[model samples]
Target: MAEVRTKSGEPAKTAETKRPKRADALRNIEAIIDAATRMLAVDADASLNDIAKGAGVGRITLYGHFDSRAALLRAVADRAIAQSDRQLATLDLEGDPRAALARLLEASWELTHRYGALVIAASQALSPEQLQRVHDEPAARVRALLERGRAAGAFRDDTPIEWQVTVIQAILHGASTAVYRGEIAAEDAPGLVRDTALAALR
Candidate 1:
């Protein structure tokens, strides 16, 4: 029997051998993503050159990790979404649906405010299907909470649950915009979002 060999007539590389050098590469990737997140949050049209500089990396280094601005933006949005998921998962959402929602809103608002216009950048870069999948988990959390609230008579059941979820998302997005435009104080957005959503549900 003949043994298989690589194109170079050497044994195929093992998984461990194929692994990229970790420390520096990981640090550079994280730095680039962090910088992209910060810059994109402030300006959806923030240039890639600016982001690379903010990351303390040369343009070549940024391009080495992320092929294009869209790729980097996707990475930044993914990290933000993952962090938001972990934070939301920690909340006690078992009782008093309204109170639970208020807690959720407070946390969600913090994330929304932190990420700001990054969502707009992501929407423009990612396809709608990709964006929807990214939001699925967080949206499911709200949908589940709404189902509970409606079942317990804590929230109105007149509208579709999906519509309610859309409204909640809109309110959060609008609040973020309001803060950016100086129409509403950031400190007051949580309470206002909570009140507005709860009232709308009723």
Candidate 2:
């Protein structure tokens, strides 16, 4: 074949040549997200200019990436949910049900605690439908694990799986809320929350 060339008679970019720009773009997006998450968590009323300054970017750059504050908040929520799913995915689903469930509980508790402020801010920005859509992925994973536990005779079968899972979720959420509200110390939270979830489920 003849040598490839652009319409301008210049060589086209190879993958190596295109990589750095793509990497920079990814870094900018991530920076915007990280800054937005931190700022919004501290102040729900934080302005776009404040976020852009925190991200070390201009207003045009922030808008170019996120479009709107609500859009940015949704992105933050999506990220938290995605991270939670990834953490839950790391558990040994085929292992002992209680052990696996405890792993999930511990992982999820740590995640929620770490993102507590952001989660609260996102909850205010997202509607019930939007909230459920973003949250459902992790919940489905938990449901599947619970189902597996029930099938393996680890969980009580007297109550419907739906009820049991709802209670389990409530307990986790309540535990995280307690941690956020100063009802429970941060150092004491993980074990206390894990024990509470184990007792509720088992």
lDDT of 2 by residue, 77-145 (tens): 778777867777777767998888888878777777767668778787777986786567667877898
Model 2 lDDT-worst window of ten: 1-10
Residues 94-169 of candidate 1: C-alpha lDDT, one tens digit per residue: 9999999999999989988897578777877777776886568778999999999999999999999999999999
**lDDT of model number 1:** 0.84
The per-candidate count of clashes, in order, stands at 0, 0
Give residue 189's lDDT in candidate 1 (0 to 100): 97
- lDDT of every model, 2 decimals: 0.84, 0.75
Which residues of candidate 1, in runs, are more than 4 Å off? Answer: 1-20
What lDDT does candidate 2 reach at residue 147? 90
In TM-score terms, candidate 2 sits at 0.78
